[model samples]
Target: MKEKKSAKTYKPLQILAIGAHPDDVELCCAGTLARCIQRGDKVTIALACRGDSASMDLPGDKISSIRSREALHAARVLGAELIEMGMSDYGVDLTLQAKQVFSDVIRQTAPDVIFTHYHTDYGSDHNNTFVLVRDAALAATVGNFRTSRPAVSKSPLIYMWEPLAGYGFQPEIYVDITETFSRKVKMLNCHRSQREWFRRRGGVDFLDYIEVVAKFRGYQSGVRFAEGFIPLKNWANIGARSVLP
Candidate 1:
């Protein structure tokens, strides 16, 4: 009889998702993150801004507080830890200070994979967040780039999640989220303040909008529901193994 090969065993990944606003991660890659959690991975959702200016009528501070609570609820729904950078809405910048802060987060989380906004995504906050995360992933592995935490041994793999409405983003990979689609919807619905904010500001039902986008991506990927991603694939961030759930 021929000898049988042993089954491969995989380790749980530490996933870090950095977003420009409270609900950005949920809007873009919640399904993928939900799949990661289902496979026993630990996920960290880091928001560059508190979304203080997302409301039409509420004061900045009041809306920020409400959004923070909503973000916590959303994190709970995904079973992920939340990190609020407390940066001002529309105020995220690609400064050295911002880089250091993100590098520290990378070190503290020690993620095996990272997901963030596409570089050319709409809004200054989202674009700056992409730059900050891209640069910080490198900084986190440099000993001279000092922070509250020590440098990580290796840079983590970085993947850019879809932009709003999938504009100008060509996904290199797709994750079938059909099984986790309901969880993704639940996670996004946790951001109740955003729903009302979008309705008032743009007459858009945020939930309906996201569902439509998910369905479109699913169609493109031949799945019932899906989320797409583009890997950064820089030399330092490349690895032989696949990290996505």
Candidate 2:
């Protein structure tokens, strides 16, 4: 007898995962994004900040460039296109301006699925990224709002990725990523600046946080490792029908 394979609903996804920091997307949706790509989805990542906050000695502008490069490298490793909203570090507010940027990204990427920080987070950037991504995912279609980017599809599926949760985080949808766990680690390792920064907290070993989170979620879903996501909207159209025949 032969082992069976899981269903490969390889939908072509115009997917976007937004983050407040360069490493946020790697920590949150990199595994899921890898899985989507493996199954033939087109994925994109938008960083709200270049993660200049990780350093104090360096000039913000200088660190910002380094972080953006690091984010591009990480996204490339995960096989996703990368964009930076260039919102000021720690300056991400639920302002119309932020929404305008979100509107632009959504208009361009035309995401079929949008991922971002959970509603409950410990940082202003994280919270605000969620507000803008969620709002823009739905609002990108309205020309009246007037984003410079050409309008794309309306009402894409939106999900919230991990919240870093030490403040008591929870997830609604858990994706089994046991097979893709190593790939997730690979994605994290691509963010060199972050890897170096976390080393101070406890180098290389500290990187296991992503794996630990995935393993915990995988257990919930009966897999060895996984990433969890909570939909911004209560329900989404999830089925083979959404996949191309």
Candidate 3:
């Protein structure tokens, strides 16, 4: 395919996580992002949605602004760059137009690794997120797509972070974020809306719940805390030497 022509430049960033909602990336892979930051890697979180339609209490638009601001906070806490696609929160339909938008972002960021929601997710937004990211990343390398965005040289690594626990899911890779547990907490704390939700009315402690999940996943990696993901089978490379075992 003829590569697209552009004046845009690519960065040697190590990681990028795309989420269906504003906070999804932080919840799913903040720990991983934190670890990458510590290793001097440039990490980014691209929000697929502005999160305008995500809420049971606060007004969607109001909550959306709050969520957008909070995402910057979470990204700051993890020392990662955060970009929102500015798409409607729950209006992510799988389409060529959507793919074009996603492809543009991919070309702009030029990430080395990309993470998004699993396709078999509980929410339609999350499922569509997977489709969008997959198609976008693949299209980002093709020039014939005729996008204003420049085509990236190498295809970024693609990974899918799981939904909440009790979803009967498993991870193909676990990043031992023991050293970044505190940073993870810092990132999660930036999610003030979530804290207010479960803390004020729900009368439940989500922090404690996430603590257990972090520890459980960490245990699998023989660490203090961790986030897990299932790497895309075709996109990920493997060899005897690549096996963790």
TM-score of 1: 0.96
- On the 0 to 100 scale, the lDDT of residue 230 in model 2 is 63
The runs of at least 3 residues in candidate 1 whose Cα sits more than 4 Å from the true structure, single-residue gaps closed, are 1-5
Q: Count residue pairs with overlapping backbones in model 2.
A: 1
Best by lDDT: 1
Ranking by TM-score: 1, 2, 3
Number of the predicted model whose TM-score against the real structure is largest: 1
lDDT of 2 at 5: 81
lDDT of candidate 3 over 1-245, digit per residue (tens) = 99898775533356778888876776777777776776667887888787776566878779889988888988887778888888886688998888998888888888778888988888778999898888788888988886787788767778788886638679878888777778777777888887767677667666786789889898887887888888766643222222111
Q: CA lDDT of 6 in candidate 3? A: 78
lDDT score for candidate 3 against the true structure: 0.77
The local lDDT score (0 to 100) that residue 86 gets in candidate 3 is 85
Per-residue accuracy of model 1 over 29-98 as CA lDDT, tens digit each: 9999999999999999999898989887889999999999999999999999999999998889878999
Give the poorly placed runs of model 2, Cα more than 4 Å off: 1-10, 201-205, 234-245
Model 3 clash tally?
0
Worst 10-residue stretch by lDDT in candidate 1? 236-245
The lDDT for every candidate, in the order shown, is 0.91, 0.77, 0.77
The residue-level lDDT of candidate 1 at 168 comes to: 83
Compared with the true structure, what per-residue lDDT tens digits does model 2 show for residues 1-245? 99788895544878888889888888877778888888888989988886767864678888888888878888888888998877777989888888889889889888777888887798889998888877787678877888898766557777777777435666767776767778778878877767767776545553678867777788788888878776654433232233211
